[model samples]
Target: MRAVQVTEFGGPEVLTPVELPEPEPRDGQVLIAVDHIGVNYADTHQAENSYLAPSKLPLVPGGEVVGRTADGSRVVALLNGGGYAEKAVARQDWAFPVPDEVDDLTALSFIVQGSTAWLLLRRSAHLAEGESVVVHAAAGGVGSIAVQLAKAWGAGRVIATASSAAKRELALELGADVAVDSRAEDMTATLLEANGGKPVDIVLDMTGGSTTDGSIKALAPFGRLAFYGMASREQPKPVELRNLLGHSTTIAGMWLPHVFTLPGNVFGEAMADLFALATAGEIRAVAGGEYGLSEARAAHEALRARGTTGKLMLDPKR
Candidate 1:
């Protein structure tokens, strides 16, 4: 099997393509002939050992995969690791059968990016009808879907923010009511202006640093902000609980892995809903560039540089 391995902690340059022996499945696991692998920001963090969890040496840096099982079932699995290869193993419970109406890339989209977008809006933010929303980094995988989901779920207004005009334009195409500059000098003012000079009800932010601070400042009374990732590689100013008393605002943190710990089908239920939406043509997955298994380095380089939009993918068989 051909795979990309990271032996040292650094950047995209560390991902090396190599030939490795095929992995065997255990009792509860099934072997998959990988078709397409989903690349995510977490993959970059995993390669550089900057993720929430520490990674071991010689790690294969992909988690979501769309492949065929030994029984000829086409499925998508979200694994712990080792997805960047021609052959990978996934636990039976971790793999879900992809609907015939959904293509491999579309199924791959919902596993990590789509699920997070659903949980961020439906669970963490507790979105309500007729409420305003702010989606940061709105052209990326999670952001792109979040923008559409916010509107589909009956948000009164959806404001999208992105670093470039082209990305913002894509957000608007995805159903965001308004698009604003994410690199604005005053993010709070930018958001307020986009929302018709009013505070927003919900905000989904993955970019940390001042963006987080600005989102908090722009929250309306009882507004909710779901902070998920620190894409900016910077931390926001320390927050004071005392100040939250004024607006009764709430800041909730979401880590997808933790949601799995709850004794329910949270992950599965979300995946099913996303797949249905994709099948019904209610939402479309925005795809970025596709890379072969060997071009993993270039994929990571583009992702880390924020030079790509939507979902980045790798073709393991290529």
Candidate 2:
């Protein structure tokens, strides 16, 4: 099987094409004939060895795929690794059948990004109707999902933030009620204005640097900010508990793996909801750059540059 391998940590250049034996499914796992493999910022982190959880050596680099089984069943799976290949394996419990109404590439987008967005609202932030919600990095994969899910799930106002105007527009297309420059010096003010001169009710934040501090300061009384990823590769700016004390602002940290650990059909339930939303035309998965599997290096570089939006995917059959 053809796949991309990273033997040493560095840059995108470390992702080299190679041939490896196709993996067989373990006792409780299933083998997938992979089609489109999803690309994510996390992939870039693992490639550079900059992730909070260090990656094992000789990693295959992809964690999710939309693929098929031996009997031609369409499905999506979250792999431990080894998705950047013609074949992959995942635990049986982790694999979900792709709805007939959903296409391959769009289905691929649902694994990490969709699930995170779903969990952020349903569990993490506990967003309520008519609440104003702000989504940071609103043009990236997870951000796009967050934007759409916020609107679909009944948030009164969904504000999206991006570094560029083009990204901001894409967020609007994804159902964000407002788009603003993420690099704007006055993010708190922007949020206030978007919320009709009031502090925001919920903030879905992933960039863990300065933005975390700003979101905390912008939180309305009893507001919750769901802190998830550290895409900026910087330590989160500390928020004084005193500031949150009287306002009742709370910072709830979320990581998807932890949710997976807690139990019953979380991913499955999320995927079902995601597919229904996509099929109903209420939400659409944005498909980004399409690359041949051998072009893994280019994919990594593009994602690391933070210039791509939507779901980045690789065609293994290519």
Candidate 3:
């Protein structure tokens, strides 16, 4: 099987293309012929050994793939790893059938990015109708979906932040009520100004460091800030317990994998809702550049450079 492997920890340069043996499925797993593999920020962390969980050597770094099983059914599978290959194995429980109304690329989005966005707003933030929301990295995979989902759920104002003009424009096109610079020196001011000088009700933040710190200061009373990723690779300023208590604000952290552990198939339910919303044209997952299996390194480079938008994909058959 054609695949990409990371034998050493460093940067995107470490991802090397090589031929690997086919992965066999165990009793509860199914072998898939991968069509589209989802590339994510976490994949970069996995390659560099900087993810939340430590990775072993000689890793095949990808987790989401849209593929076909031996039974000829097209499905999207969330794998433990090895998705950057022509074939991969997934536990049957983690794989879901793709509706005909959904394309492979869109289905790939729902696995990691879309699911994270949904859980961030609905579960972690507990967003209410008519509330104001902020979405950082607003043109990227998760941010793009979060923007649309916030609006679809009846948010009064959706403030989007992106590093570039084009990305901000794209966020506005997607449904954000306002778009602003992600690199603003005063995030509080930028957000407040974007929201008519009012504190925001909800914030979906992945960029850490100053962004998170500033967002904490810009929250309305009882507002919720859902912290998901640290895309900036920097830690935010420490929070004061007194301030949180005084304002009655909540800062909730979300990791998609943890959502899976909750009772009642939450992960599957979110994926299904996302697919249905997408099928009905109520939500759209943006598709970014597609890379061949051998071009995995380039794909990682683009994502890390913040030069791509939406969900990055890899075509294993290429």
Query: Model 1, stretches more than 4 Å misplaced?
Result: none
**Model 3 misplacement above 4 A:** none
Can you list the residue pairs that collide in candidate 1? none
Prediction RMSDs, each to the true structure: 0.8, 1.3, 0.8
Which residue pairs overlap in candidate 3's backbone? none
Give the better candidate number (1 or 3) by lDDT. 3
lDDT per residue as tens, model 3, 1-318: 899998899899999999989999999999999999999999999998888989999899899999899999999999999999999999999999999889988999898999999999999998899999999999999999999999999999999999999999999999999999999999999999999999999999988999999999999999999998898899998888999999999999998889778989998999999998998899998889899988898999998888899999998877
- Which of the predicted structures, 2 or 3, would earn the higher TM-score when compared with the native? 3
Determine the C-alpha RMSD for candidate 2 after optimal superposition of all C-alphas. 1.3
What would the per-residue lDDT of candidate 2 be over residues 31-81, giving only the tens digit for each residue? Answer: 999979999888888888886678989889888998888889888998888
Model 1, 198-300: lDDT tens per residue? Answer: 9999999999999999999999999999999998899999989888887899999998888779888888899989988887788989989899999999999
Q: By TM-score, highest first, what's the ranking?
A: 3, 1, 2
Single out the weakest 10-residue window by summed lDDT for candidate 1.
Answer: 100-109
For residue 25, model 3's alpha carbon misses the true position, in angstroms, by 0.4
For model 2, the run of ten residues with the poorest summed lDDT:
231-240
